[model samples]
Target: MTTAYWCVLIAIFLPYLATGAAKFFGAGYGPQANSDPRAFLAGLQGWRRRANNAQQNAFEVTPAFAAAVLIAHQVGVAEQLLLDQLAVAFVVSRLLYFVCYLADWGPLRSLVWAFGMAMIVALFVVSA
Candidate 1:
């Protein structure tokens, strides 16, 4: 219902998108297609790995967002700037992170990862 919620939802989806794209283009590097679920899943392992990254990112950000929201609500800081910024940071960092992960960007990926965590911390601090 809120921007933060939407950001989390987008975060939840990005990895799946990245994974699907990887599977689509990963023809030569994977298993032969077959009716077997195991074979089909094997063909999409690269996509699954990317999806794992997305899952991890979701796991990292969701708790922070929920905690920030609850803290803001309890502390009467519901309209705080940090909450909004957290959403922005979560979205931007996630987008960059997915790009970096998929494109094999090295150190820059770590920087984006740090930025996202810092944003979550900032939100927590402001809410507290």
Candidate 2:
């Protein structure tokens, strides 16, 4: 499989990392919390809340990125190296975006989000 394809897998799993953070990284989490993870997650505040939001955002964005990569491969884009690099860059942007969200860096998080979206658009464009 191509590096971009692997990136698609990474993109798929990334949100779980954020959700894990939401469930484990902050106060009040325990084995009992796992019994009602949804409620536990909803009750989170501050950075924990942000982690949940980031997880949601990652889920929202992943499909677009994955579809773009699949479409790129389907159309047989000649610029394989470029596509892989863009995919990697998107993943990096996502990681940074997660951090920015958790740290409450609204401006930088938005910027990184836009960058990842641009990468998705570019993936489609390159495939075309």
Candidate 2 local lDDT, 22-127, one digit each (tens) = 9877778888987889899898899989999999999999999999999999999998999999999999999999999999999999999999999999999998
Colliding pairs, model 2: none
Model 1: per-residue Cα lDDT over 25-67, one tens digit each: 5554344443453445444555455544654565666676566
TM-score of each candidate? 0.67, 0.96
Evaluated against the true structure, the overall lDDT of model 2 is 0.94
Residue-level error in angstroms, candidate 2, position 47: 0.5
Total backbone clashes of model 2? Answer: 0
Prediction 2 TM-score vs. true: 0.96
lDDT for 48 (candidate 2): 89
> Local distance difference test, per candidate?
0.64, 0.94
* C-alpha RMSD for every candidate: 4.1, 0.9
